[model samples]
Structure formats: C-alpha cells, structure tokens
Target chain A: MIKQLILIGLLGILFGVFFVSMQDIQELYNTFGKDYIAATGFADTGSRNLVTAILLDYRLFDSLFEAGILLIAVSGVIWISKHESQEKNAQFMLDKFKTPDLFVTFSRLVYPLMLAFGFYVIINGHVSPGGGFQGGAIIATAILILYYIDADKDTNIALIVTIEKILYIAILLVASLSLVSRGELFTNFFVIDASPDTKAIYLVLLNVMIGMKVALGLWTIFTAFLKEGR
Target chain B: MNPLLTFVVILIGFYGLSTSSNIIKSVFCVTIIESGVILLFLNLGNLDGGVIPIIGDALPVGGIADPLPQALMITTIVIGSTVTALALMLCIKVFHHYGTVEWAEILSRESGK
Candidate 1:
C-alpha cells in the first residue's frame, strides 16, 4: 500500500512538472513576440525558409561534417563486406524471388515513378521540406524494389559505382568553391550572394549529388546484409 | 489534443526499448524515442498565433514560432537517421558474428567463453 502511494505521488509530480514546462514555453513565446526574427537576420541570407538558412548556411561546417560521416560509413561498410565476402558466399542464396508475376509487374511500374519523385524532391529541397536525406531514402526504396524483382539477375554494381564517383566529385567541387569564394574555406558558401539563380543552381546540384550518394550507399549496405544473411 | 500526447509517445517508446528482445526492434524503438523528443521540442517551440521566422516589410506584429528549435530538430533528425543506420549495421554485424539475434543467447555464449 505504501509503495502504491509513492508511485502515485511520483506520477503526480511528473505531471505537475510537464504542465509547468508547457506553461513556461507559452510564457517565453509571449515575451519574445516578433523581435526574434528581426534580431536573427535569417532572411538576409536569401533563403526564405529559416530552417534551410540554418542548415545550409549558419551551421554549414556541421553539414560538411555530416557528409564526412557518410563517407566514413560507406568506407567502413566496404571494408567489413570485403573481409567477410568469402564466408558470406558459401552460406548465401542469391536467388530467392518467389513472389507472383503480378506483384513483380506492379513493382516494376512503380519503380520509375518513385525514382523520379525522389529526384524531384532533391531538386526542390531548397524551397521545400523534403531534402537530400529524405529523397535519397525514397530513391533507395526504388532500387530495393528492383533488386527484389530481379533477384536472379546480376546486381547493378555499375550504378552504385557511378553514384559514388559523382558524389565525391560534387563534394570536392562545392568545398573548393566555398573555399575560393570566401576566405573561410569550410563555411556554407552556397549562401554567398552572387545571384539568386546561382545559389539555387548550386543548392539543387548539391542536393541531387548527396541524394544519389546516400541512396546508392544504403542500397549497397542492404544488399551486403541480404547476401550475408542468406 | 494537448501536447501530452508527445509524452505518451515517449513513454511508449521507452516501453518498447525496455521490452524488445530483438536488436533490430530495439533500434527501431530508439528511433521512435528520438522522434518523440523531436515532436515534443517542436510543440514546445510553437506559438499560439505566429508566422514563419523570416524578416520582411510584410512581417506581422504577433508572436513568431521559434526558429532555433526547428533548426535543432532538423539537425537532430539527420543525426538520428545516421545513428539508426549505424545501429542497424551493428545489429547485422552481431547477427553475422553470432548467428543469432537474441541478446540473451549472445550474452550467454560470450559469458561461457
């Protein structure tokens, strides 16, 4: 009985804390009013979306670091797969497509549309909510569907290699351009105001490159797992 | 509904994390938990009547939703995706190494060694 009371008491206190926190947030909003944006100078960056400004400009170094992370992950996966390839082959069954013909045809019809949608999202990321990461996942979904449909066929290793090369080249180009335009090399150079058109072009190009890279990288990793798990 | 729903989601995620035996399931639970935190943050930062946090001559005089939290959430989402991917990869590695995904079996086998 004593333990039950203690539990109830704890729950009540937690509820009280939550209520107070919400009230505090509301109070803070009341206090700040419109002065918050005026003080931030976010609109001056030429990006209408405040979130985009922060992501592509304000904390660009962090974004570059994230790209580095993708590189490291891809390299690590490659290393691990190479080490375990021989072991994986003996146990793996590369041919396992037991689905109906109708399902395969449906997936084939949907795959191209999905890929196009992914590309659209990547291209329009600067002006919208969907960005490289979201689009890349969508693209990977398309590739995965293809892989499932054609399990017996030789995997499209060339597609993955091409995407990887393109991404590396694009990253290098962007990084170099940022370095040259601004003395602060690793800063978010894409936001620098040469022209609105130029910035938009660069943003779209970077998004597409990153999207392709992530999609291919994820596809490779998943295929490696499927091969090993079989 | 009230923002309390966010807390409920968090609790559900915690329950999932604590009870799940499969490594992959636990990783997904962690993603759910992270998403709950993101939702909570977004809710906390939202103003009752506000506009997007962008400065212009046409700006409103009323409250403006906090841009900082939105920015933080984007960063959090990216980090969360990477972490979840790495966790799944780790689970795959564990499965490859031990031939089983149950934490108990793996632990017992390691202990016996």
Candidate 2:
C-alpha cells in the first residue's frame, strides 16, 4: 500500500511538471514554430507529401535504425520463447481446427486488393500520404490474411528470409552509392540538382525497398510466433 | 491547440500504470501512454487554423501545419506498437512458465528459486 501511494505521488508530481510546461507552449503557428523546411519541401525532395519527404529524405538514417530495432526485437522474441511444449501445442493447433470456407473466400477476395493497395501506397509514397512503413504494414496484414487462409501448410520461410536480406542489402547499396556520389551517405544523390524523372525514380526505389523489407520482416516475425506457442 | 487534454490522458495512463499489477494491463497502460504522446505531438504540429501539409496547386502555401512532428509521430507510432506487441508476447511466455502474470506472483515465484 505504501509503495502504491509513493508511485501515485511520484506520478502526480511528474504530471504536474507536464501540466505546467504545457502553459508555456503557445500556438505553433503564431510563434517561431513554423515548419520552415515544408516551405521548400517539394523543391528539395520532389515529394508532394511533406511528411514522406521528412521521413525518407531528411531522416532516412533514423528510419533505417528503427527497422533494425524491429529486427532485433523480433529476433529476441523468437529466441526467448523456445520450448518443447510449444512445438507440440502448435502442431495440435494445426491439427485441431478446420479452415472455414467463408473465411477462405473472404480472404481470397480481399487479400489481392490489400496487396495491390499496399504496393500502390509504396509506389506513390512521395506523391501521397502513405509511405514505406504504412504500406509495409498493410502488406504484412495481407500476409497475415494468407496465413489465416492456410495455417496448416508452411510457406517457404527461407525464401522470405532471403528476400528480406536482399532488400536490406539493396538499401545499403543505394546508401553507399549515394555516399560515393556525394561524399556523404543518403544524400538524395539523384534528387538534388538532378532532373525530375530520375529524382522521382530514386525516391520511389528507396520507398519500395524499405516497404518490402518491412513487410517481409514483419511477416517472418508473425509466422515465428504462430509456429510456436506458449 | 489545447495540450491539456493530451496531458490529462497521459496522466491517466500514468495512474493506470501505477495501479496495475497485471502484465496485460501494464501493456495496455503503456499503449495508452504512447497514444497520448502521439496525440500531444500531433497537436504540437497543428496550427490553430491550418490545413494538412500536402503540397499542390489547389492547396495554399500558408496555414499548413508543421510536417516534422507528424512525420516523426508516424515512425513513433509504429515503433510503439511493435514494442507493445513484443512486450505482450513476453508476458505470455512468462505466464506460461509461472502460471501467473501478476508482478507480485512472478516475483514470489522467482524468489522461491
């Protein structure tokens, strides 16, 4: 009881600081908090979507590390949850349930649409609100739908892993090529001071690679969890 | 433009975290906090009377909200959800091992070792 009280008191104090700090924050538009980069975002990045420009072009390094973090976390989960009972339980799960035809039909109907929409989002990341992460998540959901349709059959995990590796390596290759071209990494090498067509192509390529890597990585993680139980 | 609402939500999340002993509830509290923080960030970027920051001939140059915070929040939301999912997975593993997910019970079981 004492410990709980202490926790509450500590939280109250912390929130008090937040409440006090909020008062000082004026409306962002009236103050100097204007997004100055957004003013020239299209000129600099050739992306109509300012958020995508900030994400892929300005802060590409951070996004790469975020993807890496997800990889590490999923790997950790797979590593820690290993047990003999889990294998048996997963096998039991496979043997117990029959796939409903309705679910199968529904998934078949919607899965292709989701896949196409995901690709469209990744392809048009620069032109629209959707980007690599969002598109990848959608594709991952589509993979999840595929999983639901046929849980008994195991897809080629090795192939997915290989594709994920190739995509990551491609991203690295692009980054290194940019480094070589401009003496700095992720320099928007083809975008800045380049023609319109190549700039659009470069951004699209980056977004596509990131999208594929993210989708494959997430699908692998989900399957790893599904294959094991506990 | 009011940050007070988001702050209140964050405080509620903190309170939930402080009170909860269940691992699942803890995950929920963390998610609530993450959502509150995201809301706060989106609010920070929003102008008092502004539009989305998409650029085109139809959209005006001025009155656009800050794009940086919204962009950062996008990645932040993804990362937060992934972390919460993993945490819940770990909690399941713990529950399977110890037959309980309450922190006090888990602690007692570990201490018995």
Candidate 3:
C-alpha cells in the first residue's frame, strides 16, 4: 500500500508539471478555424448547433467508427453474458402489473413526457443543445422507468439487439449516400446548394436514426445486466 | 487551478485503484479516472468569455465555446459507459468463478489451484 501510495504521488507530480507548463489554450491551433465554423457551419450542415455540425459532418467518418465501436462493445457484452437459460423468444412490452400507488402515478405522469422530450431533443438536435446521443439516452431512461413501475414487465433484449444492428446498417447506408452524389462520404449532397428545408430534413433523419440506434444499444446493455445469472 | 483539481480527481481514482482490494471497487476507480480525464479536457476547452456551442440569432460564433472538445467528449462519455458496463460484467463473471470479489483472494486462489 505504501509503494502504491508513492506511485500515486508521482502521478500527481507529473500532472502538476504538465498543467504548469500548459500553453495558452484560448487561441486554437488554427486561429481561423473557430471563426470559419461559426460563419459557415450552418450553411454547410444546415444545423444551427455547430457541435452537431462538426460531429455529423466535419468529423463524420470518426462518428461512424465511434458508432461501430459501440456496436462491437454491445455485441461483446451480450456474447460474454449469454446463457442457455434465456428464453428463445423474448418481447419488449410495458409493465402490465401494478406497483405501489406512488410509483404507478409517477410513471403515468412522467413516462409520456420523457418519451416526448426524447423525440423533441432528437428532432430539434440541429437547432438545440441536444442531439442523437443525449436524446437517445433520455429515451433509454424512460424505458428504464417501466421496470420501476412493474418488476415483471417483459423486455425483449434480443429484439433490441437486432434493431440496433439494422439501424447501424441504415446509418452506414445513409451516410454513404453522399458518396454517390459527391466523391466524399458522410457529406450530404443536398448540403452544397440545397434549400434550408432539405438540409434540415437530412440532419433530422440522421438524428432520428442515431437516436434510435443509441437508445436500443443502451437498452440492450441494461437488459443484459438485468438478466445476468437469471 | 481547476485543471489541477481535475488532475487531483484522477489521482484520487489512482489511489482508489491501487488500494482497493475488491474487483468492483477497481471498476469504479476506472470510472472516476474517466470522469477526471473528461473534466480536464472540458476545462482546457472552456473559454474565458465564450458562450455555449449552439448558434442563435443573437449568439454568433465569434465568442462560442470550442465545439471540438465538447464533441470529442461526447464520444468519450459513451465509450466510457460501455467500457464500465463491460468491466462490471467481467467482474460479475470473475466473482462467479472464484466466489469472491477481492483481488488478492482471487489471485491467491489462482495460485493455489
């Protein structure tokens, strides 16, 4: 323990040294970059949110690989934890059983609002702070509420996994559409000289696909944990 | 100063990882480390008088926060959660195998076998 403590102290010293020598961070490496994004990001991606524009357009290929990583991770998790005892056919349904008065009332009031907000965030991602990942997480939280309302609520993990895989493929295909129109991937053809409405649709479509994919992926992981050793 | 604090958070995680005997505690330590790293990245990217990354009619891009770090951090957050889930799942399997969550106990048992 003493030796480990010393190692931690050394780590802290290293971090301190790095921070002390850190350069001024306000001026980015490219002085022109932030201004460029702010000026043209909307025209380029039709998304009011510059971060989303950067994510789904500027560094889109990276985003694709990022989603792929999640896909692989989810698959690995399910494979590692799978058991023969699991039902061959599982389904996802809301809680049919009743809980305490308070829990049920809470679910009834909050669940719809949560679900609607998830959609709102996703659809308005181009225009707001929320986007695919955040909105999808919110939707996943809403789904989790069902378990609290009724412990016996039937959830279909396999179905969710399948849906996630399909969505990923769709995302890849949709992203590749730009490859045909332009010589690059993930850059929308409609972006070059398209109307604002078309650009908005493109961003919304991508957001919805990503939102669904993430929500399903997260739900699968949650279900896997719940079914562990069961 | 805030950067130093974030670094301290990382050190705290390191301290926990080095001292914690249990497997689950180690997983939590890694999570703490991830959080600290995320915080540090955001701190570095935080501008003095910058607004949020969202562009509006009134809020222009001239004084907006750096979008690069925020975007990268979103990816980092999702990756971290998946990693934590996988780690916990592994911990569960390890416990099932050795009948204990303690690192030393598991190590000792392995050698005994």
Candidate 4:
C-alpha cells in the first residue's frame, strides 16, 4: 500500500513538472527574435541560409571532425568484423537466405527514383530546408532497405569500399580548397564574396559525397551484422 | 506552447531515463528529451505575424519568418537519425551478446561473463 502510494505521488509530480515546462517555451522566441538571421547575414560565408553559414563557415571544423568520427567508426567496425570467426561457410549462409522475389522486384523499380530524390535533396540543400547530412541519411535509408529486403543478394564489398574511399577523398579535397581559398592552412574557410554559383556547387558536391559514403558505410555495417547472425 | 512545456518534456525524459529498464526504451526516452530541446529552439525563432522565410509572392515584404530555426532543425534531424541508428546497432549487439535486451540482465550477464 505504501509503495503504491509513493508511485502515485511520483507520477503526479512528474506530470506537474511536464505541464510547467511546456508553458515556458514562448520565452525563447521572445529572447532570440530575428537575431539569428542578423548574425548569419554578417557572417563571412556567402550562404544565404544562416544555418548553412553556421554549418559550413562558423562550425566547419566541427562538421569536418564529425565526418572524421564517422570514418573512424566505420574503420573500427570493419576491423572488428574482419577478425570474427566466419560462422557457417559463406556459400552456405548465402544459400540459406534467398532474396525474396517481391523485394528484388520492388528494389529494382524504386532504386532509381530513390537515388534521384536523394541527389535532388543533396543538390538543393543550400536554398531549401534539406542539406548534405539529411540527404545522405535518406540515401542511406534507401540502401538499407534494399539490403534488408535482399538477404541472399551478393554485395560487392570492394566496390562499396571503393566508393566510400573516393567520397572521403573528394570531401577532403573540397575542405582543402575552402581552406586554400581563405588562405588558411588547416583552418575553416568562409568565403563571403564568392558567387552563389560557386557555393552551390561546393555544397551540392559535399552532399553527394556524404550521401555516397553514408550509404556505403551503413551497408557495410549491416553486412557485418548479417555475417555475425549466421 | 511555452518554455514550461519544454521543461516538462525534459522532466519526463529524465523520469524515463531513471525508470526505464530496457535499453531501447531508454534511448527513445533520451530522444524524446532531445526533441523537447529542439522544440524550445524552434519556438525561440518564431516571430509574431511572420511569414514563411521562402522568397517570392507568398510572403509579405516586411514579415519574413525566421530561417535559422528551420536550418537548425534540419541539422538536428540528421544528427538525431544517425544517433538513433547507432543506438539501435548498439542494442542489437547487446542482444546478440547477452540474449536479452533488459539493461539489468545484460549487466548481470556481462559481470558473470
């Protein structure tokens, strides 16, 4: 009886706290106002979107390092999986898991559309709501769906790895170019006077690379898990 | 609503963090809590009588809505998805190793192993 009472009391308090917190959301708007836009407008980067300015300029280093982190994680997963004992023979495992006909047909039908949409999001990230990370993740989602549905399909691990490598190299090149343009070695470059066309090109390129890398990385990781399961 | 509601979400998230025994459930709770913060941010950027930030005839000349929040939201959304995927992968690994998804049981088993 005492325990039940205490639980009830806790629940009541939790709900009360939740209710109170929800009431305070309005204050945040009052404080920030249009300052967010104003700040972005003053930034050295040429991107019109403040968020883009912040991401590609003010916080470019963080973004670069974040990509590095993903690289490390991918490398770690590959290293770990490579050493694990190969359960049942590869051929046997492959044979046991047949790709469903419906899944194969659907994937074939949808893959091109998914890829096109993903590219569109990546390219238009600068002017619109979407960006490289979001677009990349969407692409990754499509690849993941394909992987999940086609269990018996033989994946070209080497090809995936190659694509990931190329993308990483391309990103590094873009980052390097940005740094060079700013005359800062190993530093973030926010070129304020650059033409909109240049910014769009760089942003779109970055998105496409990120999309490719993320999709491949995820596919590789899933493949490792499937191997582990077998 | 108001900042108070954001706080409420945080509090609820904390409660879930403290009480939930399932790892996946706890991850979800944390996500919910993060979402509360995101909501606070979005609310912060909103202005009275503002139009959508998009260019052209849809928006009035003077009333441009805040664009920063939308961009931030996009970043947050991507980060959230990545975190969720990573957490799910971690959960799967935990399940594979311990044959259970409950936090306490997994910990006990790990200790034994």
* Predicted structure with the largest DockQ when compared to the true one: 3
Candidate 4's error at B43, in angstroms? 2.7
What tens digits encode model 4's per-residue C-alpha lDDT throughout A143-186?
76665555555666667777777788777777777556777643
- Number of the top lDDT candidate: 3
User: What are the Cα lDDT values of the candidates?
Assistant: 0.67, 0.77, 0.81, 0.64
Worst 10 residues of 2 chain A by lDDT: A86-95
Off by over 4 Å in 2: A1-10, A27-35, A83-86, A89-97, B57-61
**lDDT for model 4:** 0.64
True-vs-predicted CA distance for residue A139, candidate 4, Å: 1.7
Compute DockQ for each candidate against the true complex.
0.35, 0.60, 0.67, 0.32
What does candidate 2's lDDT look like per residue over B1-113, in tens digits? Answer: 36777877998898898789899998899999999999988887773657777888455645578788888888786677667668867887888889998989898888999
Ranking by TM-score: 3, 2, 1, 4
User: Which residues of candidate 4, in runs, are more than 4 Å off?
Assistant: A1-50, A76-83, A88-104, A156-166, A184-191, A228-230, B47-49, B52-73, B96-99, B106-113
DockQ of 3: 0.67
TM-score of each: 0.76, 0.89, 0.91, 0.73
User: In model 4, how large is the Cα lDDT of residue A75?
Assistant: 61
Model 3 Cα lDDT, one tens digit per residue, A27-77: 444435667787778778888899889888888888888988988889989
Task: In candidate 3, list every pair of residues with a backbone clash.
Answer: none
> What DockQ number belongs to candidate 1?
0.35
lDDT of 2: 0.77
Candidate 4 lDDT for residue A210: 66
Cα deviation at A106, candidate 4, in Å, is 3.8
